[model samples]
Target: MNTLLKSQLWRGLLLAICLPGVAMAASIQALNYSSREVDYIAVENPGNTNSGGGGDSIRPYGQGGSICCFTVPEKWHADLKVVVVYQLSPDPTFHRETVSVPQYPDGKAGDIWLIVYEDGSVGAVVSLYGPSRPEWPGKIKGYPVPTKEYRDERRKQKLKREKASLLTVERGLLLRGNSLPDEKVKEIQEIIEFQKKVIQSLEGNP
Candidate 1:
């Protein structure tokens, strides 16, 4: 082969090996907890005080509580900033417990409507709702009734409830300082890109 062609081939081979290492550096492995282990996950918002009526069988709280923890890769910890996003409903009448992220070591917990770490890089969105309460004739016994005068108050409330019932979408990322790493962020970028395409395709958007 010609010298210039050989040199180009060598460069391509080197890049192929180095690229995977760069992608692996910023990746995180998330561990979804069972009902028996203790782990710590960070929270975003601090004052959101809602006890989501105990926790359901599917959703557990605290140590031995149902939670998902991310075991961050060691190399990225020092150089990367992790961000968590918590998405919660803005409605005021929901009877569920306040959403929160438990602090590490201290095991302390607090209400955070949504937690965003590293700005918008990485985070988990949580849904907080209460179980249905019993009903009575004059007024639904335990649940509070709306006093708003709007003609479609019930319709508006129904819309809000449906919105609140949505699964909170949480995204996580390992970014360099506050900015996304140029070439280094490719792996995650590809995942995000693919998701965007999938969503657009599903929505029939061009």
Candidate 2:
């Protein structure tokens, strides 16, 4: 091949190799700002498998981790929209809302976030920052204020988890205590007593 023709062919090959990488993939994540827990949340777009992602057990005012492998074009289009399907805790029925893909800042796409609002409405935003960061693009600021009932529920859950952890530790101590010397076994027993008292306190006993 001629020198100029060979150079042109190599340039074309390099562009082809880099073009796919320019279409970057963004992770799909769910942020729940509502009082209710989200049992599940999913993003769907017709005929676009790369736009499909979902997550489950997203707590109120918390993020449910990211589902990967979704892409958003650098340029915005009028027809770009996605369907957000979600189910709240204790609700067997699922609900869906159609939301437009908001423009990414600087005309570049980042992670896609599906935000569940306090009034059960869903919103979409694309940003490199998460909800915990100040630069988060979601309209809801900070987190959902913890209601009394929510606080109580979290406290109960914490108590249950701590009690279970203490029980496991106590079991391990008992297993090792049998092999220890008399003084060591006595110390272990004292520790066990303290753990029991803590458990009792967690259970609201006087």
Q: Where in model 1 is the C-alpha error above 4 Å?
A: 1-20, 25-74, 89-206
Go through the candidates in order and give each one's C-alpha lDDT. 0.30, 0.74
Winning model by lDDT: 2
Per-candidate TM equals 0.17, 0.61
The digit string of per-residue lDDT tens for model 2 on 153-203 reads: 777887787778778877877678677799977887787687777767767
- Give lDDT for model 2: 0.74
lDDT of 1 by residue, 147-197 (tens): 334325444554454443321211445424237665646766665566555
By summed lDDT, the worst window of 10 consecutive residues in model 1 runs over 51-60
- Clash totals in order: 17, 0
TM-score (C-alpha, index-matched) for candidate 2:
0.61
For candidate 1, the TM-score is 0.17
